[model samples]
Target chain A: MPQQKLESVEDLAAKAKALRRDVLLQVYKAQSGHPGGSLSWIDIGVALYYHEMAVFPEDPANPARDRFVLSKGHACPAQYALLADQGFFPKAWLETFRQYPTKLQGHAENHYTPGVEVTTGSLGQGLPQAVGIALGLKVQKAAQRVYCVIGDGESQEGVIWEAAMAAPHHKLDNLCVFHDLNGLQIDGDVKKVMNINPVPDKWRAFGWAVKEIDGHDFTQILEALAWARTVKGQPAMICARTVKGKGVSFMENQAGWHGVAPKTEDYEKALAELAD
Target chain B: MAGMETAGVGGKVGVVMDSLRDAYGDTLVELGNEGANIVVFDADLAGSTRTSKFAKAFPDRFFNMGAAEQGMVAAAAGASTTGVVPFVSTFAMFATGRAYEFVRQAVGVGHQNVKIVATHAGLTVGEDGGTHQCLEDLALMRMIPGMTVLSPADALETKQAIRAAYAHKGPVYVRLTRDKFPRIHAEDYRFQIGKAVMMRPGTDVLLVGCGLGTSICLAAADLLAAEGIEATVLHCPTIKLFDRETLLRLAKAHRAVVTCEEHQAHGGLGGVVAELLSEAHPMPLRRVGVQDQFGQSGKPEKLLEAYGVTPQAVAAAAKAAL
Candidate 1:
C-alpha cells in the first residue's frame, strides 16, 4: 500500500545510491559486465521497482503482478542489485553475479533470474517482448502494467522500430518503455557513433505518448509512470536523460567504463565516495 | 475441407491430392476446435500462409504481426514464456532468412516453445522468384540446437505433422509448400516425429526422399519396378531428428541408397542421409536434388522438373547408383 504513493525523493535517491553501490560491487566481482550502462539506469530501476510497480518478488510469475523487462540487457547489474534489495532472490545472488551457472549472468535473462520477464542481452529484443506481453495481457483483460527499459544506443536496431510501430498500433496503453538516454555506448558517445536525436519526436511520430524526463530524478520517473498509466489508446515512451557512468566521480560520463569494470583501488574509492 | 476424410496407416497411397497450405488451415481449425492455449502469428501473410483460418476461428488468440518477421518471432518467444503454444507462420524466406538471428537468439538461445510453420518453402513458391524460394530453410533450421525440422510431403502428412509438432513441447520448424502435392499416405496417416516411414520395400535400390521429393521417389519406384528394379522407398519427413536407426538398418539391408528432395543437395534430406550413411553404414549413394543454385520464376511443377527434381530424375539417379 505504501508503494501506491511515491516515497520521499531523499529516501528513493538514497535507495538508488545503495543500488548503485551494489551494481559497482557486482560488476567489480564479475570483472566483465557493463558497469556504465548499469549505473546510468539504476535510478529508474530504484524508482520503478522500489517506489512503483506492484510486483511480488516471491511469486515472480504471478499472473496478477506487473511485468518489467530490461531491454538494455547489458544493464543487468543495476537490475540485479535492485531485485536483490526487493528479495526476488537472496541479496547473496549479487555476490555470485556472473559466476558461471549462477542466476546472475552478465546480462539479464528470464530463464536464470526469477523476476526477469524477458531474456534480453541482444539489444532491441526486450521492448518487442514487452509489447507482445502487453498485447497478451490486454487480450486477457488483465490489470497488470508492463515496464521496459531500452538504451539510447540500442535504438539503432531495426527491431526496436518494429516494436515501436506495433505497440501503438495495438493501442497498448499498459506498456511504458523507459529509454535510458545515456549518450555513451560501447563505441563511445551515441551521438557521435550514431545520433538518436529527436528521439521523443520519433516516438511521437510512431504514435506513442512521449514524455521527456531526467532519469536520475525519482520524482520525474514516478511522474512519467503515473501519467503513462492514465494515457489511453497508445503506448507511452519515457525518454529518460541520464549520464553514462552516473554515481562514481571518476567513472561518470566515461564511455570507456561502459563494459570494463573498476579495479580494486578504484572500487574502494567508489565505495568510499558512496559512503560519503 | 469440412469433413476432409482421413484413412489407414500408410494404406491408401496416392488416392487424393491437396495443397499443404489449405490442409494446414483445415487441420488448424480441427485442432482449434479441440483446443488448448494455441496462439497463431503471421507476418502480414495470413492469406498466403493460411493462418487466417486460425485467426478467424480463434480471433482472440491470433496476432497478425504486420510485415515485421524479426520482432514477430521474438514476440512469439515472449508469448511462450507465459505458457502459450505459439504457432508463428510466414513465408519461409522471411521466417528463416530475414529473421535467422531473431530465431537463433529468441527461440534457439531463449529456448522458447515456438512452432515456426513457414509456408512457400523450397523452389515451389513459384512466381515470387528466387527471393521467396527459400531452399536453405531446412539447412538453416537444422543447424539450430533443439529445433525439430519437418518437411511433410503432402496435405495429410502436413496435417498430422502439425499436430505432432504441437504435442511435442519445444521449438519446431515445419516447412509447408505453395502447391498441393500427391498424397502418399492414407487419410488417417498418423505422423510420428523422428521416424522415417517405409513407403515401399525392396532390395535393389533404396530411394529415400522428403517433401514433394517423397512422391517423386514413389513414382521413381513405380518406374523402377516396371523395369524389374524393385527399389525400396523411404519417406523421411523429419530431417533434424532423423530416423538414424531405421536408416542404418535399411542401408545395411539394401544394395545402395538414393536420396531425393526439393531442397539443396548439400544440407537437406540428401545431406542428412549421406551423413548418416557415412557414419553408421557407408554405402553407395546417389542424391537427386537441386545443385548449388537458386530458383527462378515459373510454374511450381515446371520449376521442380526444370531444376532436375522430377520422378524421372530420381529414377535415373537410383538407376545410375545401381
Candidate 2:
C-alpha cells in the first residue's frame, strides 16, 4: 500500500471523530463494551496507526514494521476501527463487534484478529508482553519498534510496574509506552479507587524517559512518538492526559460509561454532538 | 526387561542418579545453540531453576524478569508472538500457583508458543515447607486449554521432554523437581509425547506412577516380585495427554491397579488413573500419595517417606488392592 501524504491535525481530528463514532456504534451494536476508555485514546491511536508507525495493510506482520499492543485491551474499539480503516481487515466487521464468529472479540485476540499483536482483556499484562517483544526485537537486531498503549486505571496493576522497571533495565530504546491518563474508572474516579498519581515521576523513578502531552492532539501525540523514536538507551513513556469520553457529552468523565453502551436516544444525541 | 537384572532394586537407588534441573539446563543450551530464536525467561530463580545455564549461554536471548513470575509469563507470551520460542522458568509454586491466570489467559487462551519449565515442583521442594511445595501444579496446568503437561520421571526423560515441548507448538508445562532422581530410563531412551514408559513387567498389579514416584514404583515392583506378586510399573511422564491405550491394556492384564505420586492423592496421577479406570475398567484399586495434606520443612527424602511416597508404601497399596 502506498503511504498517504502526512495528514494535518485537522485530518487526524476528522479520523479520530470517525473512530469515536465507530466505537460508539460498535458498543451500541453489541450492547456491551468499554466506550469511555476506548474513546480516551482515539487521536493517539490514529497518530500511531496513521502517520507515525511504519505499518502497512498488505504486510500486517512486517518483520521491520512497528508493533502495537493495546495493553488496556477493553479499549479495543479504537484499535479495531483503526486497523479496519487502514485496510488490515474489513470495515464491515465493526458492526459485528463482540458478536459470535467475529474477529472483533470482546477484547482483542492476537490470533483471531489480523492486525492485533497480542491477546489481552486482562489488564496489567500487555506492558510486560510489549517489553518482551521489544527485547526480542532488539535481539533480532531489527530496527522495528514496539508501541504499547495502556490506561492509568490499568497502571494500578503491579505487573505493569514490573514491566515499567524491566524495559528500561533491559535498555529497550526501541519500545515506547503511552499511558492514557483518563482519570475515570469503573466505580468512579481512579484517584479515589486506586490512585496511580504522580504517574510521570513513577515512570521516571523506574528509569523511563517520560514525555507528557494532550492525548487529543495528534500533533503532540506525533511529536512525542517522534521524540520517543530517537531516544537510544532508555524506554519512553508518553503520559497523555485524556478525557474518559472525549466526544460524547453525556458520557464524558462518567464511570457509568466505562463499560455501558449508550441507549438508542442517547446514541442519536452522541452522533449529533460529534457531527460538530 | 533387557536391563532388568542389572537394574538393582530393594531401596538401593543406585541407578546412576542425575538432577532433572541440570538436564533441563543442558537441553536448553543445546536448544539455544541450534537457533537464535530460542528466548529464555527466568523469574529470578536462575540458579535454583537451572535456567541460568541458558541465561549465561545466550545473554541476548535470556531475560531475568526479577522475582516477577506474572510479568515473566506475560512477557514470554509477548515474545512468542514475534516468532521466538520463549521458555519461561520459575519455581512451580510461584509459576503455576501465583501466576496461573496470566498463564491461562496469555499463553493458553492466546495460543502462544511458550514453554514453561517450572522446577522445584511437588513435595520434593523440601525444607521450604508447604508454601514452596506445589503438588497441584500438574493438576492446575493440565486443566488449561491446549496445555501439554509433562512431568518426566528422571533426568533422561527431562531432557527429552524439553526437546519435545520445543518441537510442539503451544503452551507447555514441563514439571521438574529440585532433588536428583534415580535414572529409570536407559541413556538411549527417547521420549514420546502422551506415551508411558514400561519400566518393569508384571502380571498381578499395574503400578502406575510419574515424576520420582516412577522409580519408587520400580522399587516397589521388585518388592512385590520377591513376595510372589508380579507388578508392572508404568512410568507416565505426560500426565495430561496420558497414554490411555497402554494403561487400559496393562490394567486389564493385571488383577488390580495402584497409582502413586509425590503429590496430592485427589488430583495427581492417582486422580487421573482412578478417573480413567472407573469409567473404562472398574476394579479394586489403590491411590497412594500425600493424602490431601501439605508438605512441611524436612529433607526431600524424609518428606517423601513421611508423605508415604515409597516403595514399601506402594507395595502395601498394591497388596491391599490385590
Alpha-carbon local distance difference test for all models = 0.85, 0.87
lDDT by residue (tens digit), candidate 2, B200-287: 8878999998987787788889888999999999999998888999999889998989888888877878888999999999998998
Name the runs in model 2 displaced over 4 angstroms.
Answer: A1-6, B1-13
Model 2: DockQ score: 0.75
DockQ of all models, two decimals each: 0.54, 0.75
Candidate 1 stretches greater than 4 Å from native: A1-6, B1-15
TM-score of decoy 2 = 0.96
Clashes of each: 5, 0
Per-residue lDDT of model 1, residues A115-146, tens digit only = 88877889988888888788777766788888
Q: What is the TM-score of chain A in candidate 2?
A: 0.97
lDDT of residue B174 for candidate 1: 97
- Tell me the tens digit of each residue's lDDT in model 2 across A1-276: 543435788888888898788888899999999999999988898888878888878778878678999999999998998888888887899999999988899998888888888888899878998998888888778788899899998989999988988998899999999999999888899999988989999999999999999998888898998899888899999999999999898888888999999889999999998884
